[model samples]
Target: MSAELRDRFFALSTGGAPADEVARYLAEVDAVDTEPAATLDGLGISWHPTVRFKAVRFVDAERIDADVRELFARPSQEAPYLAAVFVDPRELSFRTFENIVPLDRLLADTPLDLDLTRRAELAEGAYSFSLRLPAAARGHLERLDALNLYVPPLNSGSRGGERFIFHSAQLAEALTKAVAKALPQPLRDGFSHVNPVFRCNRFEPGDANFHRHRDTPYYDAERHHVSRYTLLLYLTGGSATPALDLTGGVALAEIEPFTCVIFDQRYEHEGAPYDDGRKVFLRTELIFTFTESEVTHDPEIGALFGKACYWTGESVFAPELARHADAYYNQVAAAHWSALTPGADREPFVHKQFRGVHFVANGYDFWFAKSDKLSLAECAAITLLDYFNCKLGDTSFRALCQSEVIEADEADAAAWIPGFLQDKRGDSAVPPIDKSLLFPEPEEANNECCPFHSWAAFDATRSEDVIELYTQAQTFAKAHILPAPIVMLGEDVLLDPDKFVIRGNSIHVLGKESLTPVNFAACWNAGGLPGNYIDIAATVDTAHFLVPPIFFTESDDCYHLRFDFFRNSWMVKHQQVTIPVPMVQDGVCDDGDPYPWRYAVDEVSLFTDNASDRGKADLWWVDNPAVEDEMRDVFD
Candidate 1:
């Protein structure tokens, strides 16, 4: 009620006005108290009176949600925040909706505490002095302008038997609608539909490190091309949080207060932890659907979906033999898989299985059994491949293409694979890689040379077996590496095997320092290792996904925006699309220094792109739609 109006009620009733006049005053409260909201236009204000208490709330919960979603979708130059305040339960007198007899006595029986003594006083020497309640809410006075309250029952403010209250019926109706969603009807017999309830979520400390993962939990991969928005609500402040920017992600919208962050969900993300305590929020989800009836209409969309279907697949791997073929393979070595336009000439692959294949194929797996000399070489190869995939997906590669995108030039890209990839930097006359080189430094540092690359290395006995996979991979790579309009590759070089480790199966022999991979991928193009090619955290693990490639602003930063899949990473560069990724040192290279070819990027556990397993066999299966036909055809 308006303060002006509320004053009137207390004015007449406080000191006990005459009995006859009391009836007149009660009637006044009734009229305003039971008032109905005018319309949706009056959404900002509302009140509803049950028998004894007035239930109040904002009438436009729906409006607020929509607006927040819109705001979240906007990209902002400022750090965003979204905050909400909930009345602390310990402070509120929730007598209208819950069983409160026990609580009432607890307060009544308590000795006068400093905070409440002033408000709770009993008249001296009276037969039964009336008890006054203390103010029971935080930030209550400041928001009284937008407040709702419930008053107690008649004559003596007693309990039970009474089953009603009065207020703006609009308030009552709104709560009914909001709470109704959390409950199902017919299953309940009473006014639960009328009672108001809200879920409480609190943030607590979670796992330590961040996990980079890409997923579409709400929609089917094939049917939905994009989701419009994501809303994350905060209930309280705390230290731990799970949210991060990963490669291949861009803000189609934004993040901020009372804001709804709407972005292209394809951008991979990570759930990072905040050191400070931040509370968990009540989360709401919404999706804009097309064609409501059975979700069917045209066949063209079916084809588009089929082409883009890799969005749902789990990434797999080919042997590492091809990954170490110098710089070209180094890039893809870190990726899950390479995304390529089907057929020659960058065709969109009108076939269902080809669309978006690169991203789906990008984030894959390669592991080292034990640390040893052979494993390091194998890891170098496999890791480089994954990296190549990530590099292609990143902004670094996008900036390289001229005319620019390789997605349009399949032939040069495919043909350039071997020689350019093997050892592009052996020549000394080549220029050092330019920050603006866009493409990996040497044209020759591409996918050609096939060192003993494999997480498991060349088990002398299995050498022949590994060779076949390498040959196939090289062939597969040649088909997709496009002819230039300036082809820039987005890829990562994963060091998943125990590179140079002194222990077990992955012993990376600290042998003759070989900058072969670096020379091939970067310098080969420029004809020499770039003065400052980046080094990312190329990890290796045996049991957990051996190596997961994620590009970062700083080579060691795993929390930056990452591309969890190869397809998306490949598409971004190959297609030459602009997206946000951090920019590191961009000036002249660190003065003609050799690339840091051998470095220790710890074994990290990546929040793999794809879906979270809710506990099933295989955790992932080759048959998953994202892979299946697409892999079969590509591998063939």
Candidate 2:
């Protein structure tokens, strides 16, 4: 069982049902000394220690019939739960129960007329006009009405409902037969059975209000089997009717008594608040297995719950998930709206290879049915499409080009977005680096921090301007302290003008002036400076170096030693020092590193000739006057 279902199943098992129902359910749980199992037989499948009484009493025959047909017509994903509930099943005889009010009696009490002004503007009619209950079915309806009904808590805040049930074996048998006969042959074969997960609602001037949301949870990674249909039965009537949104489009309908609307639970819908008078209704789910083969012949004990699934009804509130869903919908199913409209004049715009395109969003892969006749809007309404469009942005809802996607199989498709899985590309992709090998181990903290860029001389044709920039850099460095700023004066293209910017927590960079505002908060959170930077006269021998070469660590985290070919010695920034080695070690750094040391000119003497070499010699690392120890000896 999924965490979601486990939570819900326990919630249902512990509370929300009649006392007897709860007791019976618990008894079954106690009886199961082993693993939880369902009561399976040729008669039909049901949960063990089942609540025996039928829940729904009277249903809007016309409305429910239409829903049943529509449900059977669509794919499995669309109708996760289509339901119908029997309302007032009062005991009329020893064997069966009867509905409190007959259709004629109901009509006499509450007459309905299709006024143009009052007509529901929804895609499907608001009030069911086809409420013709057969004469033979009236007793069954009464028996359904006599059933002990239970209404679960509608909202977390409100408390105004009751749960009840009186099990009747005769009624269950009759209702089961009716339900089986009602389904088409194909659906009957595939259908497992229906269980009583019922709800009764009382709509008053202040109480009848429900937000728009999808029903059953959507499945993504799991292979869980959940109920495929949600059955609803309306049993009361009043002057005020709530507006309902349907699959095809928005429609206004009456919330009159005996009016039930069964639809795919995936459809994103809403129940408009009601105000005029009191009304009551009952609802139930018609559960079906996803495939016919899932119905096993053996009727032994097994798992009570199947795999877990998740609902995306509340997903619209999440921005990231919504954005991706919108993109997927636009890429896969946006172009097929015209074909789904009842009387739209446009021809069926068919794309040969694009029919099976799937939108992979938030882990779920949404693919159109084989017919490919459903409208984009319809598909979007059921899936996460509208949430994306409403919150993220509008999706063009056009069919993607054939070249952009590849069909995986009969029921699956994959879109070929560029850069997706680009890392896996062979020759064209950047070669992977073994990150572990690139950096010193965490234990070697001193060796794990290295200079990323090198010291450069403050250089400029106008010596005064160079001096001014160097002074500014020094002042900034003094103010910010640790991770002393490395000042570079050469015209390196990488440094387009000099300005300070924060990169991570407490880590700032004197980057190009064109870069965006630095996130100082991020820098402060990262602690102090990343590494040290220093300004020197001229690191190389060039009289007018166009760009100063940066002496940085091979890796960001590692402080491992590297030979600076220009300086000709082992280089690791500890407290900073200069030790000249022979020129034979030039290019001694790793060959695989993209930034390799290159020699400028070998065999240069560090012995300066007085003041002329004064400014330029600053590029060479200097021993700290305070530390009497030789810097080279520390490395040894």
Candidate 3:
């Protein structure tokens, strides 16, 4: 009610007034009280008369949850915070919201302790009170305005939440002490003083006022550190409605000069908008974290650490790695620059642009049994190949042709595969494959079938000797080089054998429904070593697969398999004949850009101009689509 209207009511009821007039005044007062409070334009009072008494009434219930009752009984206990109430139950009260600190008192040089005590009294008595900020803190904000030291809101582009922000050590210390006094001793002990920031949020016409927000939970994975509590203090603002409202509970509309609100950080609340009016307020947060050393010692947490870091002790020394990584990143960034192509859209396959060697060591599995000398190079080749296939979908090898080189060294390799991968500086000097080789013209010749196909010369039924499947497969592969699907029937039907056998087998190709006998030379098993080590076959399915090759020489390890692309090792060997891995697109043949060789071939020419550097004749292939038909004819 306005003061003018209240004065008229009192005047009429006082001294010698008619009984009817006094009764009318009382009736009007009752009516106004029962009706909703009047609000100014663009401003409102959110009141929930029931919220303040909720805690008390809940506790008073006979059938209240035991855990909730216990939590209300002692809210300051450490760990396992109660979920029913976000704030400390002790701070909640059922009382009228009023400003304990007036603007005049805040302008005065009042001691912070006296103000803090006054604020606490209001809290204990009325349940909600807005006390004045410490005189020194208020003066500090004035000094900031005078010196023009405030910076624009850091997150202005998003929610222009702050007008300006300035840091003050003196203000932080005083506020921290004031907040510490409110919290119970148990909570105070766990609190670590983080540097506080003083920010003035402005609510003006068309400005984005504060929205509902919660502080981010501070987490430290290594130490298992996490935030426990928070404190927020509201200093000053212009609008009458620009006050803190713990929605459904308390609203400190008429705040005194240094009015502060302290609550648990997890509380869901928002700053009331000033509407068309302008308002400025200072806010500081006191963040606390719990450092429970026991988390590190717990068996499950310890196991997680081992699993997360891949059992490498290197994770323990982060500072050492950070120092080197930072310097190295800077050096690499300085050496490379990207060309800007305006209006050009990025390729779908372009993961991202990097200045230099961008390394990402995601999750990895490093459990492998060591055999023989335990060749590190072989491990690198195997790991990279596995990563290429599993993570990048095997097409990454083709995608690498356009991507910036990412140099990965042993130090940068994932912790799981430590000391296994190292940067081979000379590998960069090797030329990349020519693009023309990938997109050969129609005149290019495809791989021809072996002229003297001699696999039929061998009589399998007559031979009862046991021999290595790998050796026999290699012989058959070299002899019968056809694009059609070739099947080598081993001693067992499924190809699972610990020892070799002379069992008769059968072979079949697509369209030929009946299985042909193995003695008819219908089978060719040159597909390295199958997992079963039994019936090995390399069918013309057009699907690319990588199999562990049995190396004859120690020198033919991972490095040779990966980087020594000049040689035709069994791991990256291209087949002699070509076949269409039929891909039906809209029920028609979709040859898929006719360059499986870009992925299948080990070496690619990096020469931009086709005529400048003719590649080795032996290494090049003329991809002919007609060969697929010829192979199909042979199969049929």
- Could you give the C-alpha RMSD of every candidate to the true structure, in order shown? 29.0, 30.5, 30.5
Per-residue accuracy of model 1 over 1-636 as CA lDDT, tens digit each: 444344444355234688877676556545653322221211112222222223222122332233232211111112012111111111111111222111111123323211111111111110111112224322221122121222222211111112112122232233234333422243122322221121222323453332343333233334432222232333233332324353554311122222212233333444433445432332222333434453333322222232222211111111121111121222222221223223333422101111111111112222222211222333333333323321232222212211101122433422332232233212111111222222122121223222225323313212332233333323322222221111222332223222234333232322111111110112101112221222221111111122223332211211111223323222211111111111112122333323221111101001112333323323122213332333346666
Residue 282, candidate 1: alpha-carbon lDDT: 27
User: Which sequence of candidate numbers ranks them by lDDT, best first?
Assistant: 3, 2, 1
TM-score of 3: 0.30
lDDT-superior candidate, 2 or 3: 3
Clash count per candidate: 148, 56, 15
Compared with the true structure, all predictions reach lDDT values of: 0.25, 0.27, 0.30
CA deviation > 4 Å runs, candidate 3: 1-114, 120-137, 145-147, 150-154, 163-165, 184-194, 217-227, 238-254, 287-350, 355-636
The TM-score between candidate 1 and the true structure equals 0.19
- Runs in model 2 deviating more than 4 A are 1-173, 184-189, 217-225, 239-241, 247-252, 273-275, 292-636
lDDT, candidate 2, 302-358, per-residue tens: 100000011112121222232222322222221111121122121111121122332
How are the candidates ranked when ordered by TM-score, highest leading? Answer: 3, 2, 1
Q: What is the model-wide C-alpha lDDT for candidate 3?
A: 0.30
User: What lDDT does model 2 reach?
Assistant: 0.27
* Candidate 2: residue 469 lDDT (0-100): 31
